[model samples]
Target: MNAFQTAAERLIQADASHTPCEPLRDLIGEADQIAAYRVQEMVTQARLDAGRRIVGRKIGLTSRAVQAQLGVGSPDHGALLDDMAYADREPIPLSRFLQPRVEAEVAFVLDRDLDVEMANVADVIRATAFVLPAIEVVDSRITDWDIRVTDTIADNASGGAFVLGTTPRALSEVDLPAIGMAIETADQVVSTGAGVACLGSPVAAVVWLARALATQETPLRAGDVILSGALGPVVPVTTPGSFCARLSGLGQVSAVFTQGEDA
Candidate 1:
C-alpha cells in the first residue's frame, strides 16, 4: 500500500479496536493539512467499501476557544456515518471509544443541495429544513489527545458518535445567534454557552461547511445532518453517567454512557 493508504488502514484498525495510535505526522513525516484530508478521504472510502453509509458531516473547531486550544485558525470537518448516529437518551457503550468527550451543538438538517461557493448565513438558513439540539461524542486516536490540525483532520476530526434531539424547530422559531445551551451530567451543570459561541452563529458555521464542501465538488444534500461544532466546553466521559443538554427554544437531547456494555 502507498503511505496514505497504509496510514488510513492503521486508523481504521485503531478505531475498530478502540486503541490509540501514534500521530500520522510521526509516521508520515510532517504531513500538511491537504495531505491529512487526503488520508481522511481514503479512510472514509474504506469504511464505505465495508458498507458504512455517509449520513452527514460535522464541522469542528468553529469555536474560537477550541481553535485557540488546538492552535488552529480555521475549522475542520469529518464525515458522519449512519452507524455513528444515536437517538435521544440512547445508551452509548464506553468500550467503543479509545478516549471520549462530549459537547453540545446545534444540528442542521438540510432540505436541499447546497453547492455554491461563498454561501452565507441566509443561504444556510434557507437550505436547512430544521434545527435540533445535539450532543457530539468526540474521541481521539492520536494517543493522549496530542494532536495538531493535520493529526485530527486525518482522524476524521476526532469524531466518535452523535445523538439528535426529537424536536426540530424552524429557524424562524428561534434566534440562531442568541440560543443558549446548558450541558449537564447527572450531578451538575458542567458547561454552558450560546449559539453565538459557534463562529458567531450556528448558521454561519453551516455556511462555512457548505462552502468548504462545495470547493471539493461535494454538496450538502437533503436529509443530511450537519453538526455545527461545540456550543460549550467539551467534557470528558470519565465515568458512566447520563448526560443531557438543553437548548433554548429547541428542546433537549441526551445520552447515557455505561461501562463494559453494548449500546
Candidate 2:
C-alpha cells in the first residue's frame, strides 16, 4: 500500500525471473522506512516462491565505504538459499544474472540457533562450527543501477548468490579477525583484504545480521550459514577466466567462467 510496495509489486510482475527490469525510482519517490522494508519483504517471498530455498543469511554494509555507497549508516539483511550457494571451483552460468559481481568474505556455519538479543558477538563465535573463505556473487535487477541509496534498498539490497570454499579451520581453532583473504583473477591478484574488514571481526557482522533477522520474527536456525560481509572492495565481473579467494585458515574457493560465453 506504500509507494515502494506498489512499485515493487509492479517491478516483480515485470521481472519476477530476476532478469533486468526498469528502475522504479520515479514511482517510489523518497521511500521511508516502512516502504523500504515492504519492498524487501515482497521480494523475499517472491524469491522463495520461485524455487529459491532459504539456506541462511547475509549481512551487508559492514564496511564504512559500503555504508556510504549504499547511503545508509546501518547494515541490511537478506535470506540466502541453497540454490544461491555454490561449491568451490564450480562453474557459474553468467547468463543467469543481470549484472553480477563478487565479494570476498568469511562464512560461518552455525551449530545452534541464534535468537534475538540472546545472540551477541561472543555468542556468534561460540555457535559457529566452522569458518571458510567465500565468494558471494551479487546481482542487481534495476536498470543502470547507478541510482541513489534508497533505490538499492528497495531493490532488496542487491541480494545475490554465494559460493563457499573448503572449511579450513574450526571456529575454535583460529582467530576470525586475523583471517586474511586474497581475491585473484587469471590476470593477477585483483584485491587483498582481511577478516577484520567485517567490522572489527566477522562475529560483529553476524551479531548484527542475526538481530536484524530477529526483528522479522525469524530466528536464525541451527546449521544455517551466515556470510559476515565483504572483506574487500567488490570486484566487477568483466572477463571471467577464473576467480578464487583464500582465507587465512580457510583453504580456498573458486569459480571458473569459460570463454565465448557471457560472463
Candidate 3:
C-alpha cells in the first residue's frame, strides 16, 4: 500500500478499536502537507463508505495558543460529520472518545453558497444566517495528543464532535472581534478568551475557511454549520462533567459528558 493509504488504515484501526495510535507524521513525513491531506481524504472517504454523512466543516488551530501547542504556523480544516453533533443538554458518552479535549468557539450557519474564488469577511457576513456559541469536543487518535502540523491535518484536524447553543444571534447584534468567552467545568472557570483570539475574529476565520474550501472545489453551502475554531485554550475532558461556555452576546452552550454506564 502507498504511504497515504497505510496512514489512513492506522487511524481507522485506532478509531475502530477505540485505541489511540502513534503519530502519522513519522510515516507521512513532518512537513508534507499535501500527503497529509491526502491521508485525511482517505480516512474521510472510509467514514462516508460506512454511511456517515458530512454536515459541515470545522476550522482548527485558529487560536494562537492552539497553533503554538500543535507547532503549526497556519490553520487547518476538517469535515464535520452528522454523527459528530450533539444536542444541547445531551449526554455525551465518554467511551466515544480517547483523550478528548474541549474548546469554546463561535459557530456560523450559512444562508447562501460561498462559491467565489476567494471569500472575504464581507462574503462571510453576507452568507451567514446566524451565529451561536459552540463547544468543540476535539479528540486525537494519535496517542498522547502528540501531533505535528501534518499529523493533525491527516487526522481530520483532530475533529471529534461539537455542541452548539440554541440562541442564535445575527452578525449585526454582536461584535465578532470583541465578544468575551468563558468556559466552566465543575463550577470553576477553566478557560477564558475573546473573539479576537480566534484568528483576529471569528468572521475572519470563516472567511479563511470559505476561501480555502472554494479553492478545494468544495464551497460552503446554505445550512452548513461552520465551527470557527477555538476562542480559548482547550480543556481536557478527563472526568465526567458538564462544560458550559458562555459567549458574550452569543449566549451559552454546554457539553455534558457521561460515563458509559450512564448512557
Candidate 4:
C-alpha cells in the first residue's frame, strides 16, 4: 500500500482499538499537507462505507495564535457524522474518546447549498438559516495529541462529537464577531472568549471552509451544521462531569460526560 493508505489504516485501527497511534507526520512528512488530506479522504470513505451518515463539517484551528503554533496560515476542516452528535445536556459516554478536549463555538445551520465558486462571507450569511451556541468535543487519535498541521488534517481535524444549544437565533439578531462565550463545569469558568477569536468571525471561517470544500468538490449543503472554530481555548475533559457553555445572546448548551452507558 501507499504511504497515504498505510497512514489511513493506522488511524482507523487506532479508532477501533481505542488506542492512540503515533503521528502520521512521520509517514507523510511534516510539510506534505496534500498527502495528509489524502489520508483523511481515505479514512472518511472508510467511515461512509461503514454506514456513518454525514451531518456537516467542522472548521479547526480558527484561533490565530493556534494557527501560528501549528505553523499553518489557514484553518483546517473535517467531516461531521451523525454518530458524533449529542443533544444539549445529554450524557456522553467517556469511553468513546481517547483523549477528549472541548471548545466553545458558534454553529451555523445552512438554509441553502454553498456550492458557488469563490464563496464570500456574504454568501455564507445568506445561506445560513440560524446559529446556535455549540461545544465541539475534540479528540486526537494521535498519541498525547502529538500533532502538527499535517498530522491533524489527516485525523479528520480531531473531531469527536458536538453538542448544540436548543435555541437558535437569526444572523440579524446577534453580532457575529462580538458575542461573548464562557465554558464552565459547575464550579468555575474554565475558558472564555468572543466571536472575534475565530478567524476574525465565525461567518468568515465558514466562507473559508466553503471555498476550501468547493475546491475539493464537496460543497456545503442545506441542513448541514457548520461548527466554526473555537471562540476560546480548548479545555481538556479528563474526568466524568459536565461542561456547560454560554454564549451571550445565544443561550447555552451542555455536554454531560458519563463514565459509561450505565452511569
Clash pairs, candidate 2, are none
Ranking of candidates on lDDT, top first: 4, 3, 1, 2
Of candidate 2, the 10-residue stretch with the lowest lDDT total is: 254-263
Q: TM-scores for all candidates?
A: 0.96, 0.89, 0.97, 0.98
Deviation in Å, model 3, residue 234 alpha carbon: 0.5
Candidate 1 per-residue lDDT, tens place, 1-263, comes to 88788778889888878789888886555537788899999989988998999999999989787788777788999999998999998888888888899999999999988889888878888899999999999999889998888889999999999999999999899897898999988769999999999999888889899999999888889889999999989999988888999999999999788786554
Better of 2 and 3 by lDDT: 3
Model 4 worst lDDT window (10 residues): 254-263
For residues 98-209, what per-residue lDDT tens digits would candidate 2 score against the true structure? 6778889888888888886657777777777888788988777777566555556666667667888877578778787898888889768988888788888888888887
lDDT of 4 by residue, 158-226 (tens): 999999999999999999899999999968999999999998899999999999999999999999999
Clashes of 3: 0
Model 1 regions more than 4 Å off? 28-31
TM-score of candidate 1 to 2 decimals: 0.96
Question: How does candidate 2 score on lDDT?
Answer: 0.76
Question: Evaluated with TM-score, which candidate comes out highest?
Answer: 4
**Candidate with the greatest lDDT versus the true structure:** 4
lDDT of 3 at 129: 97
Predictions: Cα RMSD each: 1.4, 2.7, 1.3, 1.2
Local distance difference test, candidate 1 = 0.89
